[model samples]
Target: MTAFLLRKLGWAAATMLTVSILVYLALEVNVDDVAAKVLGQFSTGEQREAWLLANGYRDPLVLRYGRWLVAFLSGDWGLSSHFRAPVIEIIPARLGASLLLGACALLVMVPTALLLGVIAGMRPNSVMDRVVSVFAILSTSVPDFASAVLLSAIFVFWLGVLPGTSTMLTGFSLSELVLPVAVLALYSTGYLARITRTAMAEVMASHYVRTARLKGAGTFRIVFRHALRNALIVPATVVMMQVPWLLSGVIVVEVFFAYKGFGSLLYDAALNSDIYLIEACAMVSVVVVVLSQILSDLAYVWLNPRISLSGAERSAGVTDA
Candidate 1:
């Protein structure tokens, strides 16, 4: 397990480094334009040249990338042109807001999805199965934006109980968080439920389940001890894998609900062409995605410990020894 984690972390680092290089090269496309955009069109040629020289655009690509990478490692993520603040300072607040929202969504979504799926899979062809399947399909079929709009119309316009925007200007507010979290949870639940349902159904049909039944095991024991544990392996990994999807979904949901999260911040940076902010956001996103996959792999192994042996261990001929 230690080896696995060390390997995954190394890959995550490499992925971030590669993404950084790509981001830097993309920004290097038109140094003159970046300077002009940052300094406004009315700035003189000397101003652009001065900006380029100051930012190390005049240096070799290798040196510039090395400096940028070192600075990024040292927590200097550059300055945001739009916010007129340090990129490091701006990103953490937005990222924290997003993480809070995501944590809430996951708390609500995961158990609900697993319960619905397990209930449906317990009796695959029964009336309950059909009902849960239909619900899952309908929920997953609708996009996040549409869900947000529909939810807002119902909660904000018809009921008038909850706030439409999830802006955390002062601090956290449960009422404001309702619609955004609901939208994210509802959008993802259907797909995850389907996965769990399939896994549960397969486990319920496996020979071990039959053997448990033949050995006079109670329905509860067969379901919980024998079946549910194996069924969770796939769903657990998938649940961890949803982090990136949730982040992507946040872009639409955050914008629609006026939530100042990492996704919406990225949107703002792109619209304003804040290259520094964009780079920071991109790097952060890559890190999140790679880290999520690592978590997924860890979950998979945790659920099935027999496969925890690394290739190096497997090749050592321990069985003969």
Candidate 2:
């Protein structure tokens, strides 16, 4: 367990380093006249040159990246070119909003999806299964923006029950979150449900389930106690994999709703060419992806300890060989 965790963490760190380098290079190569943009368009040549030197843009690419990486590790994410504030200082509130929305959406998504999926899976090819499949397909097919618009029109314009925009609310409220959460949940719920249904259906069909039934186990006992545990591995991983998708999707949802979450913040930074802000956001996103995957792996091991135990035994055998 210790070795496995250490290895995963090491790989995650390496992945982050690689991602940071690529993000930096991509932004640097694509963005033209960055120093001038940071300084101002009308700034004099000397001022631009001075700013570049001061910020180490004049340094070699490797040196600049190294410095940036070191500084990022040291909790200095640099100043936001657009906001003129440190990137670290700017992220928390926006991150909080994004997390709030994401959490609420997941809370709504997971159990509902799993229950629907279990029902469908247990009765594959039945009317309930077909209906669940259709709903999942329809939900996945709709783009986030279109869904946001449709939802806003219905709930906000037609019914006038929910707020149209989630912009700049001083504090959190479930009423304010209803539209955005629904939109986000709608997209992810479909994918998660489909995966869960497939996994659960396969588990239900397996020999052990038949054996349990032959042993006089009740339908509920076999489905819940036997099938559900093994079925969870794939669906859990699928849910974890959605972290990046959810993060990216939030940009459109938040922008459409005028929500000032991290996604909206990212959109603003990209629009204004806020290089430091972009870098910080990208780094944080990569970190989230890494951590989520690690957690997912741990969950899998917890669900099926034999997997990790076998893995460790294999490692030991290889070491001995």
Give the true-structure RMSD of model 2. Answer: 4.0
- For model 2, what is the error of residue 316's alpha carbon versus the real structure, in angstroms, after optimal superposition? 20
The whole-model lDDT of each prediction reads 0.86, 0.86
At residue 48, give the lDDT of candidate 2.
81
Give the per-residue Cα lDDT of candidate 1 at 92.
88
- Cα error, residue 6 of model 1, in Å, equals 2.2
Q: Can you give the lDDT of residue 205 in candidate 2?
A: 95
Candidate 1, pairs of clashing residues: none
Clash pairs, candidate 2, are none
Instruction: Put down candidate 1 lDDT per residue, 1-321, tens digits, no spaces.
Output: 677778778988888988899999998557898898787778999999999998888888788889988998899988788889999999988999999999999999999999998988888988988888888889988999899989989989999999989887777889999999999999778888888899999999999999999999998899888889889877887787789998899999899999999999999998998988999899999989988877777666667676654632342223213
Task: Give per-model CA RMSD.
Answer: 4.4, 4.0
Error of 2 at 124 (Å): 1.0
- For residue 117, model 2's alpha carbon misses the true position, in angstroms, by 0.4
Write down the TM-score of every candidate: 0.94, 0.93
